[model samples]
Target: MEESEELQSILSYLPLLMRSSSLFWPSQAVETLRELGGGRVDSGYLLFQAISHLRNALSLSSEPLSPSTALGYALFFDEVMSGEESRKWFREVVPVLGNLLLRLPSLLETHYQNPHNSMRTATALRLLDSQLPGIIFLSQELIAALLGCSFFCLFPVKDRYVNHLPVINFDELFASLYEDYNQKQENKIWCIIHYFQRISSNMPKGIVSFERKVLHLKNDYTHISCPDANFWSTSTVPLCRVEVHNSGLIEDQSSDAVEVDFANKYLGGGALGRGCVQEEIRFMVSPELIAGMLFLPAMADNEAIEIVGVERFSSYTGYASSFRFSGDYVDEREVDDLGRRKTRIVAIDALCSPGMRQYRTNFLLREINKAFCGFLYQCKYQLYQKKLQDNGCSSALFDAATSTSMETSEGKFSDHKTTNSQNDYHSMDQGNNIGVATGNWGCGAFGGDPEVKTIIQWLAASQALRPFISYYTFGLEALQSLDEVAHWILSQRWTVGDLWNMLVEYSTSRSKGETNVGFLHWLLPSIYGHDEVIQTQLHCVSCSETDKRVVGMEAYLCGLLAHQHRYGLVDYSNYWMLCVALRPFISYYTFGLEALQSLDEVAHWILSQRWTVGDLWNMLVEYSTSRSKGETNVGFLHWLLPSIYGHGTGMDFSNLA
Candidate 1:
């Protein structure tokens, strides 16, 4: 029964196998073939070992062909091999495998149509770094050749941290086959193999462009802390038209717009690993997108990478763990003068907080900045290129084929090596007024709230001057109020600053324990003009029931503070206000609210440590928030506060008043 089940799984992959040439072998079989290649150089021993192994395996079995032999037969047989004739045809398939193996090196070195493949680099492909705004243009033929290298596992292993590049080889994908043979991996393999077959039969003459965009924050300050930054606050841009569809998908529904890849910092994420989510699935269907991993480094917080003109080759069903390759898909998008498809993909990774910690104001700013960096169309590179050409320099002076440095009064360009050995491919369109096609970015395993992420993208697109945004919710019922919220915001004619300020206010309230309602429901209070809690019921707890109030963290702190205030336990509600202000810190301490029951207790603790009331509160808030990050639980305050309180463990606290 087990042997039969295994055979059935192999049978399932046969149709896609026949449609695509058998040269795209499964990873397990590919790894076996790699061993035959005898390291990087194929000295004819590869063909010898493969043929001898098949010959020996065939002699042993007349009924069931060995796995390697079956893969070899898959290369030649247009029809399914069945019955007695399968055994007779095994010998003929062996030489076909040898012929392909022999031709593999030359095929990758030079395309049949182009005699001199100048794009094929003699050394490793150049890496794109975060220091400079850079673009790489590659002919579709070059991408096909590089992908062929990946299929054969020819690229060397790279450490992402040291090299700042993602895994470009197919070893990991193929290695997964033997490690754990599963349906998802099989589906992924099908999509990639089918892409190779399509291109091998009819190579695209067009090009694809990959460019990195960086938003330089002023004074070297990071993200939200740069108060002088006016990227959002200065923008009076109004929200654009948003079409929220719960039933459709981003890639299919917004085919005409720039598609969002909910990417990892390391571009493809688990696309080469065990992951099969949004970014991974997209990479599988449009395998050319994977070529970005060959050169682009992990994205920095302020950076985004955009790839224009890569064609999608396959359709898919399901998502994440349940994902499956549906079948071959024919891309019908229009091609431009560059022979490029009119498709654009911008990859932006969001802050990954798998808990309520994501509700913090700082994280909100990070996400907004990252999205804006991607949506913004103009870059200093384009501006400098135009400036140089307008000065009567030959257009070819700055042609992508040469190693040129661009400097402007704004700033000097950081040095970047050309990605292609021959010519840097240019993007077909700048998409200045193009809308964005995105939905629930960072909402998956990253733990971002979809409601929050939707508004974040909207604010970004608006600031970038996009005309419209098509949001695909993938049928999440939590987002049924999405259309309602979008229309209401649009009806008010709120500018980018207006919506951004609202998000900042919402995050502040959430951090203070004032409200736990979803952003959509939170907006309803203003929409309907009522104080009633919209989505959830919040019950006030008395002092004694603080820990058992069915609420947590901030609520628990709120309850304890309110109870202490209601009773005349402290001389000043002002002091309790101070405690409430310091709630984030006091609540995270070892004794919880019980430690500083009243303002006097806090004052006394400070007095005991010889600190002024101002100094005490400031240090506590700064230390806790900084140390705790945005996490709800900072653990016993002793771990963090002791480091702050003692200055050093060697100091003697016994000398304090």
Candidate 2:
């Protein structure tokens, strides 16, 4: 029988169905009606009638229905799902839904339940916002319920008040199945479906909290103390430990560390839309993280959001376009003091520079401050204490947060000391010891330079007192020198300030149009030093690019002499010696075969001009082709003088090559 018809027909026989052994009814439904029996049985019958009427109304609607309504769950089980597979899946999990809705009044502790208490108002089940730093602590059951609401597209569209928040409904995800129908989007839906299935069968008993951290800063650059040359250039703190991995992912490999979400300023990015990269993929596996989007607004430059105790319910392979939902995953992370998982995910957006502007000093400072704002210990510790107290535990029960010195492969270093003593939360704490697990932030579609970004994040982590950094390169070829540069800095025992100075110097050079050299090459003096060796390497790299038209012993002699002159190894002062130098090319490669053509005139012209290797070769080509092309009879010096100066610099060949 249809769910609405079954519900309606059974209401009149509630007393009979209650005693009939053959009738099969959900126990929660039976208990619900029983609770309101006696004088309230009529009220219970009216409740079921209203639910049936709502279900019939939803059944007729051609558009999507919001899951927040009680009948929406029925619509999900009936019309939305299809095929024997969904039916079979529904049969196994329908009781959980029935019980959930029957007890929705208690599960959903809305703000209206108690208007007098501010703490309750803040913690109530509602949309999180950007006004002030707010946190929502939810039980796993409540999270599943919210996810159900999101799954059915029950959340209202972004209106004036909610426009700041990202789209929390699954309408876009569902629409894609009919509009484009690709496996990537399909896999995302599968992941979310599997999460509901898993939670419905064996609901976990842990709590999760999402807190947004905002650090107010002055708009005036002159007044702001951060990113100051003196402060950054004088920090005594050494760099934390850094380990780069060519393989693996940030979410799976660095679960113990504070995982960074390469987020869009709008928290979830295109997670509900088409974006399936770092931030989107993270949301799919741990769908509970999506709950933050319902309340959080587009992040400000000085703000970040940290989600603690979110359980990862699905595991997957591939990234972005290649992403696929692999299979179910059981979250085994241990619970914290408040019966919450210990997993912490911090969302910090990098500056989006679709062009070369990201390399500027101002954007660099913005990224550094953004990372610092996310890494502050206060975000986790202060909110943690509040959560503990809200759970009816004493804040004093939690020990004083403390931070110790960091130990690197080189040796131990003192804890990071901040110059901004005015900020009390800048003080060290043990929780600050969590390393940051990050890859190239802002480099993918955002166009940030990975090498510079790696160092920026490192400096921020050091200032925030993180002990180590698990840096994932994701196989970017640009970061090939990351290990070498990191090792050199450690070997030299350079402090954060030293690196900051180097970065500033590099940025200055870049702004003045001197970016031929990359950041890593600029930082490592030894690599860019020895002009001769660099020139030689450049030539070797472009060896195939040599003009094939010019060949034989004359070409060899020209190359030899050019190499000699480039490194300041050889010099020919007079025309006689210069003729001797050109003797090989004149005898072997010239078409006119002018072996004894008294090249002294041409040689003296070459000598007087002090021609480089390229000029000499082009002069040789002119002399040899004089008879062959017949135009050479127009006086070799006539047209050659103007063209000879074109190849003035031997080093210019390296650029061409």
Candidate 3:
């Protein structure tokens, strides 16, 4: 009965094995084939060894498959040796097996046409990072399934992962593996050869070639502070807050690329985007200067690169998709302390695309710029202005590339979203780049998502080795929230490093599809200590201890009140007022009031007159009418907070009318 049950289980796995499950243990087969190629296994042992590996890999996959998958090849083995007539036919396969094992990449390459060839594609994609193993054996069904496809696929292998493959002459291995078991057969050998040639011809150029880029940031006076907060709101308009040029096409109006006899820094697209800007600058700038930005250092998430004092040799018109070359103009820009033009170009890569399962950070295998040019270049203005406010650094004329991709994801910082156009690969081919023709090329600073741009610049400041970097943010209400959060962390006595670690954790976790993660979510578990005030029988001490444990919503409010009570806020009753005053627009989350009661808080905020009196009256009437909770309505609050706290109730709506 047990044997019959096992057989039934084996039958269940047969279809999955035949279909080429991506989870299968081709690695074991890979190892066995390599061993066979080492000449340790003789001819008679070849078929048996290959069959053993296939079975082992399947069983180890933890998915149930039929036992026949591993053992059935032995049955065929016996038949090949059944008589002299069969022996000749079987002998043809022995030498071919060894050669095929050595040419695994080409074998995988040939299998691209299979509809269910993800494993083959996966294997091929990992070819640069993995060693080629010998003699991969799946069931005959699996083998046939792989060899049946005919399509084109080339997964881009970034520069960072190419060191794993052994350096060998693939052409020789492929040539040696091409022997037809029955080469004399006109029909069999010719068709196989023709197919091999076709697949080999489709190989992409520089498929596994990549190199590192290097550019240095002078530590004149700046040190990169991790997770740029940019929290300070300056009373005076910052250089970043306004554009100096009169025209939207200021870049075009600037000294023509040819007329600007010299510059110290010029911005470019990126090293990975064919270094488009740098490539164009080559027409006017020195080739040596252009080469400096080439192959710069790798950026981790939220990192920025600044190439200082690179002279812009040419000027152009149009933005992305519609970019064009216009006539050159003369550059009259002043020199800096180092006597280099105060020109700077920055590279800021987007973290990750929306909804991608992987976060791009130091953990990424390969990284390139996305659409973060908006925040990156804008922040450069902020930094450059800051640097000027302090002092200046030495020479410029270098290049910069963002170290990693840190997309402005809405994981820990609030669910902020960018409304950039969707990225389509065929944009250029379809002529969709120039839609109406009068668009801007600049990745204008992220005006809508204040938190994203602030965090990005602040984080870059933390990691950079520049002379001066500022973390002041002009994030309106968001900045106030962060300031309060910082105070809360201080009250908790948590270190800045610990908070940075959590920031990294939240960034990575969210990018990788982790859910229920917030910047402060981890703090929740820590807040709940021990989970016990355990005592079965009631007593004075126990009852007192139970009282000490605050579990209700009121307990949380009381605790928070006590914590803020110590902040020396003069009028603690006006806590809501202070929050509303500092941040022009207030969310319930401004002080954890939203979680307590959205409607009640909104009503109270209006009656407090922290906002306009009209808004309070309007919302109060709306809430009174909706839920009939008129006790907490605006009129009651007018007497409770506003009227009592010095606000005059609007008896006349003359201005509003």
Q: How many collisions per candidate?
A: 2, 4, 52
Instruction: Output the lDDT of residue 29, model 3.
Output: 56
lDDT-better candidate, 1 vs 3:
1
Q: Residue pairs in steric clash, candidate 1?
A: 137-425, 206-339
Tens digits of per-residue lDDT for model 3, 1-657: 122221232222221122232222246655755564454543333554554454465453343223332232333334323465234333433333434444533333343333223222121111111111111112222222222110000111132123221111111111222222111121111222223222233321111111111221232223222222222111111111111221333223332111111111122222112122322333223111222222223343333333333333334543323334343334455544333343433343433232333233442212211112112222232333354455443222011111111122112212222121111111111110100001112113211223333333333222221211222332334343444443344344322233344445555655665533333322222222323111111001001111222222111111112221223322223232222111222222334332333335435444443334234334334445654744443444443344443566534433321
Q: Between 2 and 3, whose lDDT is larger?
A: 2
User: lDDT (CA) for every model shown?
Assistant: 0.58, 0.58, 0.28
Clashing pairs in 2: 66-154, 128-295, 402-429, 402-430
Give residue 235's lDDT in candidate 3 (0 to 100).
12
lDDT of 1 by residue, 1-657 (tens): 122222232222111121222223344444544454333323223432443443333231232222333232232132232433333323333333333444443443343234223334221123566745666666776677667556544444423447567776665675564456577876787787667667645777887877777777554322112222354554555676788888877778533578999999999998977899899999999999988887788998888998888998999999876888888898888886656788889999998774676677667777887888887665323433445456655444323212221111111223333343322233224433457899889997888888888888988876665567889998887788888778866765666776787777676777788887777766544332223432243321111111122221121122122244333322222233233222332222223365433443433344455443334344445557766786535333343344444445532344322
Candidate 2 on 282-308: residue-level lDDT in tens?
999999888777667788877888888
Ranking of models by TM-score: 2, 1, 3
Candidate 2, 506: how far from true, in Å? 1.5
